[model samples]
Target: MRRYETIFIASPTLTDEQAEELVKHFEGIIAEQNGELLKTEKWGRKKLAYEVQKFSEGYYTLFDMNAGPTLIAELERRFRNHDSVIKYMSVRMDEQTKAAERQKVRYEREGRRKAQAGIKERSLEEVMG
Candidate 1:
């Protein structure tokens, strides 16, 4: 399985319940195809950068998951056939990006440790003086 991120915009004209159902529908597809869904975010209705499918606003949803190429292909095919989906995009998180993220987290953790140690040392120096 490979890390993947997918974002889709749904028609804003849908009722809240309808929108939620639509989200669940796609999430179900991922599970059925053996995909691991790490996160799901429903970023409520927002104005689009430009008109799409004759609509100026849309409900945005994001999916972070791990799945193979066949799963991705099927997911995209579903999106293309779904009328409620105004637009969608899927991206595979490459190995280089994952390594860089790990390195960044490591660096941040080290920096925090150093800062805490410095603070403790400063407080000790003041008390001793």
Candidate 2:
């Protein structure tokens, strides 16, 4: 399974419940297709760079998942068919991208560890002195 990131904008007129239902519907598709959903984020309504479907703002949602080609095709097909979806895009994360993400995470973890260690060392020195 390859990793993918998908973002879609839903019509701003949708009620909060309707928007939540839309997200759940897509999530069900991923699960039914044997895809692993890694993360989901709702960015809420935001201004677009330009008007889309004659609406200046839309509810933005993002999905990060691992799935095969067939699942991706099905997911995109659903997106295209859904009326509330104003704009959508999906990008496959290649080996290079995955490596970069892992490297970034490692750096963050190391930085945190070092900061904690430095704090502990300073406290010990002050006490001993």
lDDT of 2: 0.93
Predicted structure 1: lDDT:
0.95
Candidate 1: TM-score?
0.75
Give the alpha carbon lDDT tens digit for every residue of 1-129 in model 1: 899999999999999999999999999999999999999999999999999989999999999999999999999999999999999999988776988999999988887998988844357768899
Compared with the true structure, model 2 gives a TM-score of 0.74
In the range 1-129, model 2's lDDT, one tens digit per residue, is 999999999999999899999999999999999999999999988999999989999999999999999999999999999999999998898776988999999988887998988844357768899
Per-model TM-score, in order, reads 0.75, 0.74
Cα lDDT computed for each candidate against the true fold: 0.95, 0.93
Model 2 bad stretches (over 4 Å) = 98-129
In Å, residue 105's CA in model 2 sits off its true spot by: 18
Best by TM-score: 1
What range of 10 consecutive residues in model 2 has the weakest lDDT sum?
A: 117-126
